[model samples]
Each structure stands twice: as C-alpha cells, then as structure tokens.
Target chain A: DQQVKQNSPSLSVQEGRISILNCDYTNSMFDYFLWYKKYPAEGPTFLISISSIKDKNEDGRFTVFLNKSAKHLSLHIVPSQPGDSAVYFCAAIMTGGSEKLVFGKGTKLTVNP
Target chain B: GAGVSQSPRYKVAKRGQDVALRCDPISGHVSLFWYQQALGQGPEFLTYFQNEAQLDKSGLPSDRFFAERPEGSVSTLKIQRTQQEDSAVYLCASSLGQGGWGLRTEAFFGQGTRLTVV
Candidate 1:
C-alpha cells in the first residue's frame, strides 16, 4: 500500500517563479517528513524536512510546510531555476520505529528559462 | 571514502543468474539502509543494518534476496536465480546516528546500481 502519495506526476514553471510541490500521507504515526531532489543517474539528495512538532521548516530557497490536521505537506521553492529541474520525492518515517522511510512516487518539476 | 559508494553502476544478467551488488558507506556512520527503485516508482526500503546487526529486513521481497554486513562497514545484496522482475536500481544510504539523539541527520545516498535481468 502507498502510504505517502504525490498526486502530480509532473509540473512545469517559468524561471524566477515560485514552484510548489505537494504531498500527502495516510500514516498518522509518521513524525518526520523529508524532501529529496534527484537528477538523472544521480542519487536523491536531501533538500529539506519538517517534524511533527513544527509546522514548517525552511532552508535557503526551499521551504516545507506541514499540516498535521490534513496530513498534507508542500515544498515551496522561490525563484525557481533551471538547475532545479529534477524528480522531487517526499518521504515520511516514524521516529521511534525502524526509521524506514516511506516515499512517494515522485514529481518531476521542470523550470523553463 | 567521502560519500556512500555503490559499485558496478550498471549490471546485466541473464535469467537464473546470480548477482551480488556492493555498497561502501561513509566512515563512522552507524546506520545503513538498502532500497530498490523501479521504473516510474519511488524507492522502497529493502533492509537496514546497524553496526553489523541487521535490525530490519522486512522489506526484502523474497527468500532469494539476501544481504549481509560482515564488518559493519561494507554491505552486499545478493540475488539468487535472478528474474526479469528483479531488474531495478538498488540504492544504499548511510546516516550518522540511530535516531536516538533526536538529531535529524539526513541519510546520504549513493548513485545506485542499475540491474537488468534478461
């Protein structure tokens, strides 16, 4: 069963615009959420994350907002750049369990210059 | 040495063949995990190791799949009697702690080994 889901398969946006990627999860036990960006033939790199205690976390141009009541989260990138084009995956894990991260199908984001 | 390293970036094997994939995690990392990624799908966890002790391996698909970490440094994923459905990208990741310190140390991933069984 897919516990974490990214409904959008792909997204396109112009450069210098704000890009928003959404993710939803059904597992209420998940306490930590992370976003990863992957390029062709490369491993997925950690972008940002948020915990159940906090509703939001920001790093540089990336910001992750979590809504526990709705079981939804979003990754917002300001001034999207062409280099940011890649497959973005959202993952969740229970902090106390095995810590095995459950990942979404991923969303491909393209930034047109 | 500096990052998680997975060898044999690409591998092609015939049906019924056995293949072993290797992973070398960063020095001093205490947690190691293996994941399998299929085409157009996200990565799914396969197994996990903590200092040579395999704490979790519930995600292993079947009995033909086996993994080992002899010295707590390097790991190997062995698939016996490989099948076409076994083809996918196998990834290895490592973290500094065992999630005990409450530090959200992100796991670093290797490029991954793409396995194709024909």
Candidate 2:
C-alpha cells in the first residue's frame, strides 16, 4: 500500500504565476513532510519542509503548508519561473520511527515562459 | 567529494549476471542509504547503514539483493542473478548523523546509477 500519494500527475502555470502542488498521506505516524525538486538526469533536491506541529513554513519564493487534520499538504511557488519546471516529489517520514523516506509518484510541473 | 558520488552512471547486464553498484558519501558522513526508483515511480527504500552497521534492510526486494558498508565511508549494493524487473535507477544518499537523526539532518543524494537488466 502507498502511504503517500500525489494525486496530480502534472500541472502547468504561466510565468510569474503561482504554482501549487498537492500531496496526501494515509499514515498518521508521519510527522515530517518534505518537498524535493528534481531535474532530468539529476537527483531530487530539497526544497522546503513543514512539521506536523506547524500549519505553514515559508522560504523565499517557496512555501509549504500542512493540514494535519486532513492528512494533506501543499507546496506553493510564487512568481513561478521557467526554471521551476520539473518533477516535484512529496515525501514523508516518521521523525522518531524510521530513517527512510516514503515518496509519492511525483507531479511534473511546467512553467511557461 | 562535496556530494554523494555513485559510480558507473549507467550499466547494462544479462538477466542472470551479477552486478555491483558503488556509492561514496560525503566525507565524515555517518549515515548512508540506498533507494531504488523504477520508471514513472518515486524512489523506494532499499537499505540503510549507520557507520558501517546496517540498521534497516526490510526494504530489500529479494534475497538476490545485498548491500554492505564495511568501512562506513563507502557502500556497495550487489544483486545476484539479475532480472528484467530489477531495472531501475539506484540512488545513494548520505547524512551527517546517526540513526533517525540522519533524516532530520537532511540526506544528500547522488545522481544515481541507472541499471538495465536484459
């Protein structure tokens, strides 16, 4: 069974617009959520993360929001640029349980110039 | 190296051949992890090591899969009698701490080695 799910397989947005990617999880034990951006032929790079204790966390143009009650989370990028076009993976982990990360299928985001 | 390094960026092997993939984590990092990502799928955990000691390996897909980190600085993942279903990109990641602290410290990943079993 998949503990984490990214319902949308892809999303598109215009330059300078806001891009939102959503993810859901079935495991209540997951307390930490992370977003990683991956380019073709490269490994996923850490973007932003939000702890279950907080509803939101922001860094630069990237912001991550968590709704623990809904078992859902979202990553928002404002003024999205063409460089932001890539695959976005949502990952979850139990802070004190396992050291492994459970990832979603991923969403391919296209930002038009 | 400044980041995790995985050797043999790509590999192709016969269905029954054995193959070994290597990973070199960042200097002094105490934790290493291996993940397998199939086409159109997210990365799946394979195993984890903390300073030469494997703490978790429940994610290993089969008895054909094996991994070791004898020196704690480098790791190797070996597969015996490879099959077509084993084709995937194997990724290696490392963190600066031990145990679950590795995740908290944010593990850095390598470019990954793409393996194809024909």
> Residue B48 of candidate 1: its Cα lDDT?
94
What is the interface root-mean-square deviation of candidate 2?
2.0
lDDT of 2 by residue, B14-118 (tens): 999999999999999998999999999999999999999999999999999999999999999999999999999999999988743224577888999999998
lDDT of 1 by residue, A1-113 (tens): 89999999999999999999999999999998989999999999988888889999988999999999999999999989999999999999898777688999999999999
Query: iRMS of each prediction in angstroms?
Result: 2.6, 2.0
The best candidate by DockQ is 2
Residue by residue across A1-113, what tens digits does model 2's lDDT show?
99999999999999999999999999999999899999998988888888889999999999999999999999999989999999999999888777889999999999999
Looking at model 1, give its docking quality level: medium
Instruction: Specify the poorest-scoring 10-residue window by lDDT in model 2 chain A.
Output: A92-101
C-alpha lDDT values of all predictions? 0.93, 0.93
- Model 1, B1-118: lDDT tens digits are 9899999999999999999999999898888899999999999999999989999999999999999999998999999999999999999999888842134566899999999999
In model 1, where do residues sit more than 4 Å from their true spots?
Answer: B99-102
RMSD value for candidate 2: 1.2
